[model samples]
Target: MGTFEGLVAFSVTPTRPDESIDEDRLCAHIDTLIAAGVDGIAIFGSTGSIGSFSEAERRRVAEVTTKHVGRRVPVAIGTGAMTTAEAVRLSEHAEKVGADALLVVPITYWPLNEAELCAHYRAIASATQLPIFAYNSPVLTGVDMTPNIIVRLWQDGRVKYLKESARDLLRIPQVKEATEGRLRIFGGRDDSIVEALRLGADGWTSGAANIVPRACRRLFNFANDSQNEFAAHILQRRLAPLMSFLMDKGHVSVCHTALEILGRPIGTPRRPILPLAGEDRIHLEGILRSLEEEL
Candidate 1:
């Protein structure tokens, strides 16, 4: 298994109002992240709106992101599906397309027990040579992979990382202690990146990086340097507002709107998931524009 190290961005796909992936703009978004000096780029992640996309669309995203990233940085793809077989298929395609790793979320629809969840990851790990990071976003997935289960998977040597999105910041230490620091922990909570790192997380998978890559990297760097107070200030002044909109308003909408304000052409979010409207849009655009000015 490859070591999961460094600051990574779970990039949002730039799309049109109709929700089609804007290929050129998407490439530009990748360039934005690379230019910001991020360690890696994770496309089609939860913040990237991967669940709304089809397998073919996700594969295309991975291919494009990998091509643009080249060898400058590692590229991780989110290949989690509702079924083990589908996840394996997506992961195999990612490996074939030269992705560096796979961020696998648990199957969301039919919640599985710890044993079933373990088997799902084991199956995917067995299918591909790429490193696997188990994503535990219980808030979204409706299932939580406890520390014991996480330790078990890590001991198997197939699961290399954990995207801890449980909102329980304290769990970082627990997982680290349980695994003896062997399992790399990544912060999936945008509002608590530095807190997680302070608690022994190796790095972070930031959704805010989609619009504020440099700031995210700066926050991570500052925290790594033990400048907790300074980083927390920045998070409060800048990252926190954007994260609130994403968390309270809508993730994809805020991301798309932020991209627009930044002069990128990531289109509106897909259907069934509506675009930002009313005061939410005004507030999002205002915050983004203010942030752009500051940057």
Candidate 2:
């Protein structure tokens, strides 16, 4: 169940105008990723606006995605919440609803201590049999999961994988060496995928994949082979401009705009996070236009 590898595209939770999940559009959107040959599908990750939705909506998204996809590819659900109890409930729910794996982040309103962090994950480990990814996204979550913490979690057998998004490439090999290569790793940063692959990442949990899944997979395949590294790097350069944008701007807003550009509009970002507008929208349009041949 923990066998996540090679371009695990994060699905955008497309909502209707009323902000309920647009089930049909979400299905069609995921159909796009599957057709593009993405090795796995992840829902309700940061790209899915995990923090914005309620527990019920998150469950519905997980249930609907797993039910609709139905053994086509692995589906990983993000079970991160502000508290341990909420996270545990979501983890149990993900496993119950047939999620192939679980992605967990130490979400905290106040920054969590190392001990608090360990306890949070340990409780979740006790609650579910699903393989767990201890997600490390310092930018979004405001907490850095050091290699020491990940190593300790690995030692305790609490987390099965690390979805690393903290942009420091050295942490990949650091975690690998500390865990003796046991804790599987998925790279989450858009800009550093090539280096992450070279650093022995198992795969990438990508926001850009919501826009160009095929390119992400192609980059994964090509970069893995020394013979194809040159071609892969060349493609990565073409993709770099937009990749930079997705990171600089938020994933949800940029992806929503890019999808609309591709003539497949997924609704707006939930409020408190605004839609792409003015120069940002125009800039994104230019970026998409430049990549027509690649797309």
Candidate 3:
């Protein structure tokens, strides 16, 4: 169930109006992703608003998603939390629920040091047999996983893969060199997929794929499978507007708007993160329509 590679979409957890997880909508959304041919389905990611959920809600989402997916595709569950103990608990619960892999980010307000980061990972690794995908999103997690540290985690056999999201293309090659090809790197942002692959990323962990799965898969195949540089570049260009908005606007909000525009309403985003509105919404729709035609 480990050693996974390819386009893995960070799914947006569909909720009811009251912000409770809508299991029926969530399951249906996953079914669409599997049918669209994503290599894996990741639940409780930033796109899924993992941190916004309570511990109980997170566990429930993991169980329901794993059961509904039913081994159709690899399911990577995000088990990051504010504290080491919470992270371990989430990781253990994820393992107990039959998840194929776990995405762990150093999700704490207090910045973590090199030793603390390693220890946090080691603790979670001890709790689960699932492959660990260390998520390096300094923007969100406040901890940049440097090459040396990433290598150390791999050396300890605690981290099996990396989701590099620093948005610096150079980090791709840096990670490749640091890990000596032992760690498989996945691009975390959609806009950077082509360059990431060109620089040796194994695959992409894209949130945009939730709305445009076919295009994401095509872009990956063109770059990695077909090795068609020209086609890959062209497809990435077509997806750039949506990617740009996602980067400019919040990924979750922009994606939610796109999904609703496409006739798949998953209710409003959880409180404190209102749905997109007005001019930004109009502009996002324009981009979405242009993208739809290209697809």
Index of the highest-TM-score prediction: 2
lDDT of 1: 0.82
Model 1 misplaced stretches (Cα beyond 4 Å): 1-3, 231-235
| Tens digits of per-residue lDDT for model 1, 97-160 | 8888899988577779989998889999999898888899888889999888999899989788
User: Measured by TM-score, how close is model 3 to the native structure?
Assistant: 0.97
**Candidate 2: tens digits of C-alpha lDDT, residues 36-153:** 9988889988999999899988888889999998889999999999988899899999999999888888778899989998888899999988888888999999998899999998
Which candidate achieves the best lDDT against the true structure?
Answer: 2
The better candidate by TM-score, 2 or 3, is 2
**Model 2: CA > 4 A from native:** none
Clash totals in order? 4, 0, 0
lDDT of 1 at 54: 85
Please provide TM-scores, in order, for all candidate models, with all chains considered together: 0.94, 0.98, 0.97
Candidate 3 total steric clashes: 0
